[model samples]
Target: MKKFLVLGILFALPITAYLFFASGKNNFARLPVLTEKVKDIDQFKTNTDSVISFRDKISVVAFFGSELDDIKGNTFNLDQKILEKYYDFNDFQFVLVLPEEAETRTQQFVTEFNKISESSKWKIAYASPQKVQEVFDSFQSPHKLDENSFTPYVFIIDKDLQLRGRDDDEDDGKLYGYDSSNVAELSNKMNDDVKVILAEYRLALKRNNREK
Candidate 1:
């Protein structure tokens, strides 16, 4: 019994540390800006005209779908309303992205939203399933793989193509979710996380003006 107990304790340490630390470092290391974006519309319809590059400005990418009847009300509707409301606060583009499979459902959702409100705050688009997976897989977060892999997830990439905040990081550092998804999905509780990034962006603009 004593020998068995010692072996179990030894085995658990590496597994536990990997789960808590190692994988998260890989996720944090992935630069969100360089990832190719996919949307819910067809190729021809996708807004490739102004395809946002990390070189231009910071961007907020939210994966949204109303197709899953189970989560539409709680997750989908709330996602739209949040983007529409606080959109005026920053210059960053807030985009609505859906996978090819979610097209019909997303179209209906977008149309209904446009009817109820009038704003250019959100731009909707479509992308391929494989492409979306490629973006998420690069982070290799197993927790994210199980659920949000094929659906809506959020990522905030700074001008340098670094992923700063994510809804789900490996663990809470400084007890914060300072990730893109939290700001996109939760909207209220952790908005200051988003504000801090924006504040930095503003300061850069000020510095640039002074340099001129």
Candidate 2:
């Protein structure tokens, strides 16, 4: 009887340990912090005549072109899906960084967005063409911008103004990636990633308070 009991305990021990470590690994790899800090964007101005600074808030930044066809699909995704899902999260902001040429249609842009979401959290902003290029360059964007073409990728910026992406470090910092080809899938995936990031920030705050 004693020999049988010892064998049972040995077998269960390894199984329990494996399960514990597997669960820990999954939670650890769930989200990643942007490895690089974004360039200071204080010089960029918002439509409300104020400097754009997301010091303590998570911001979604996207480059918007002036062409109607280029802008329509993205606008629908933001208004119908993203905004509707996170309307109550006051700490979040969506900054639509338009090209210098879009400056002429700023009012029209504001009116259209406001119809979908009346929150003051939405901002339409602009910067010089040179400054805009500098900002996008830091992000390591995949697409090239020609005289009349640009990719419509949305960047996720955290509370500290750092852009979030998959870190190349081999350990466990892989971030969730999405399919940009499908607007619905992209929106849903982005929404989940944002919530995970926010939850992580809250956990860090709790830990710091306990340490103090």
Provide the overall lDDT of each model, using Cα atoms, as 2-decimal numbers: 0.49, 0.64
Candidate 1 residues lying further than 4 Å off, grouped into runs, are 1-55, 65-71, 74-82, 115-120, 139-153, 166-171, 174-189
Error of 2 at 43 (Å): 0.8
- Clash totals in order: 10, 0
TM-score of 1: 0.57
Which candidate achieves the best TM-score against the true structure? 2
The residue pairs that clash in candidate 2, if any, are none
Task: Give per-residue lDDT, candidate 1, residue 168.
Answer: 40
What's model 2's lDDT at 1?
100
Q: Tens digit of lDDT per residue, candidate 2, span 54-142? A: 56777777666555355666666765666666656767777776666777776765677667665356676667767777776766645
lDDT of 1 by residue, 44-122 (tens): 2343465444334455655544354544443444445444555666466665555566666654554555665533345
What is residue 132's positional error in candidate 2, in angstroms? 0.7
